[model samples]
Target: MPLSESTVLISEVGPRDGLQSVKSVMPTAAKCAWIDALHAAGLREIEIGSFVPARRLPQMADVADVVRHALALPGWTVMALVPNLQGAEAALATGVHKLTLPVSASEAHSLANVRKTRADMLAELRRIVALRDAQAPAVRIEVGLSTAFGCTLQGPVPEDEVLRLAEAAAAAGVDEVGLSDTTGMAQPAQVRRLFTRLRAALGERAGAAHLHNTRGLGLANCLAAYEAGVRTFDSSQAGLGGCPYAPGASGNVVTEDLVFMFEAMGIATGVDLEALLAARAPLRAGLPGEPLYGMLPEAGLPLGFTYADGRLPRTPSIPRQAAA
Candidate 1:
């Protein structure tokens, strides 16, 4: 499960990040079905769920079961979020391929989200790394520096603080450190600037772009990050999740729209736009009445649209927009 250079890795976080934000908990069977559909759509990496206490977050009470089911899917790199050493231990025991820790750049946001300061989180990361070395040497550890862009709790997080935290996380022995727009306040210019600085600072250890579309800038920020040399992107199907801990936080980058944007431009994402849209069925079925979001699903494909891999439409016709 090393990072693939063949296609931009779209790490789906709907199961973990998405569900956790919602009030209703999806059934275990439905979670598996949704995940299976995502795999069918060519999503190779998925954050199945978090390993936090069930009482704390009942939505993820069956995370271990979900992880086991995702593991059974071949050629998939299953990941789970772990807030601390305890969560990491439980996640490792389930044989998750990777573990992602959220380390917030904003001290106030960090305290609100994980009840730990930046220094305490780093110390926890060291302990988790040591445990990983001892028990699961093959498992990769990633840190999503949440609130890297900005925070609702602490208006604007300084760029220097983000870089400092990223460097600190790298030194704590994690495999990669990525930035998170937990509060959805990132603009395209800021995205490019920070990612560029991150690459310059962390080199290969700098990780994915976890942007939000709160201000309708998710795809734009992603494009900016791509320009800044970030190949991995985190998105949610139907735009399902945001940080529950961060006030007024909402909207993850929509997966179908993201794939469509890249494929329409002839940048292969290795994801089938049709299949990805179809995956939304199980998501809706799992959480009945829940609102789903995405433009491509409603607009349908353009006339004679061709995927980057050269797949043709089933029945090409004049584009509706053009015909109108």
Candidate 2:
């Protein structure tokens, strides 16, 4: 299906990818409120949580609860990350709208992160697809090839390996295949070329760009991908995640900055900037003392700027007390 000019889907991954890397766990009530506020801001798709073992990632221990709450929201395409078939089963049981499986294009990173070889990860992908087919026909499966741009462990990851994994993910019966700059080493030129090639390889199934700002090129890279005809962009509320194994790296692209960039250019992201900022308050309250990153929120909106929707700039009026 062709991407419509009216809207771009910016799937928020803060609850899942953002919180996972943090040391503190966001309370369930706070998480539910955050999801609701994001939905109110016109964000239709959200990665609610990841279905990993609670013992391994305590931050996402309430994945099931979060998924349930997000599913309750109308028009929300709730998503969850599943590492393998086991995680896939758990996510399916929660009736999430989508399930994403991580497949590393870098052999070294794959081994280090998931303790599985590249071939083993592909095998697991096939198993997860089979399980999805059997149990949840409505659930869309996305294979996110991590370290597609470059790997910290192995230095330079070849483009051929990334293509190979994309083909493998499609052959393994995934609905979509996405590329991730897990190590934050991607450049805009590289993003354009790779996403172009992926479009040719996967056709309509080419998935969103999951980028990082560790090297400060995340937004630039995303713009390149957008120029290359990518419509879906994955971002976090406050830029909340990073590879726990890879130190000094930023997580996914910040949602606030991404929304601002698109809306400023009249790209029509369908997300309200003010409401998006309002969503951040709950995130801040949830993860106290944790650092939240966003350029738009810090710099404020551009002078005399207005959104295409025309609902902004009008602050909700507070009811006044009756005169005595």
Candidate 3:
């Protein structure tokens, strides 16, 4: 199906990426409620949780349950983060729509995050793909190369390395390969150039752009990737995540603001901004006292503007039922 002009797939990663980075744990029931509300807001895709070990990420200890709840929602593509072959196995067992494995482009970052060099991560990806092929061929595997723009430990990560990792991920048998600005050090020019190069190297296998607003360039970098032909974007609601290892950092690109930007530009995202904002309340209630980020929410919709529903004057309205 062709992508709708009024929408883009703003995959919410708050349950997985956002909550995992924080200290408190959101109850599984609350997580399910949040996911349900987001689906009600017209979010067709959601990264519900990660399949890592509870010892490693206690916040996602209920990933399997979250996946089950998300799958019960008709038409929603449930996604989860899987760090290695074992995590991939767990995700595949849940019958999720997609499983993303993080492969850092920066060798230093890769070693620090996953305790593996770049080559070692690629090998793990290959193993994960092979496992998926043997166990659950229907599940899609996505390799997200984190810290692609620049690294906290290794400054100015070479575009050559990023391109090489993209090529390696494609060769490693992943269905898709994405670039991530984990440290939020990306600029628009760098995003455009790298994504353009990645497209040339991996063709359609070139994956989504996972950007952070840590340095306040997340949206700009996203626009650059869009200009470079990326259709899918990974964002967190309320900007609710950050690198757990990277101290003093914020969350990924805010889903509310990102949807507002795309929908206002007349680019269909298939998401209701008002409903999307409403979904945030559960997130707030789940975490309580956590700082959420998004300019569109605080400032409200622009004056004299409209959304996909043809509502004018920029007033927030209840979401309409999606067409069958």
lDDT score, candidate 3, position 264: 80
Find the candidate with the highest TM-score and give its number. Answer: 1
Q: Report lDDT (CA) for all predictions.
A: 0.93, 0.86, 0.84
lDDT of 1 at 10: 89
Candidates 1 and 3 compared: the better one by TM-score is 1
Clashing pairs in 1: none
Alpha-carbon shift of residue 17 in model 1 (angstroms): 0.7
Residue-by-residue lDDT tens digits, candidate 1, 58-163: 9999999999999999997899999999999999999999999999999999899999999999999999999999999999999999999888888999999899
TM-score of 3: 0.93
Any residue pairs clashing in model 2, and if so which?
241-251
List model 3 lDDT by residue over 1-324, tens digit each: 145434456777888889998899998888888998999998887898888889988999999988998999998788999887788888888899998888888888888788888888888888988888888888898888888888887778888878877887888788889898888888999999999998888888988888999988889988998888888899999998978755555669999989888878878787877788889888888888888899877777765557655656335433233221
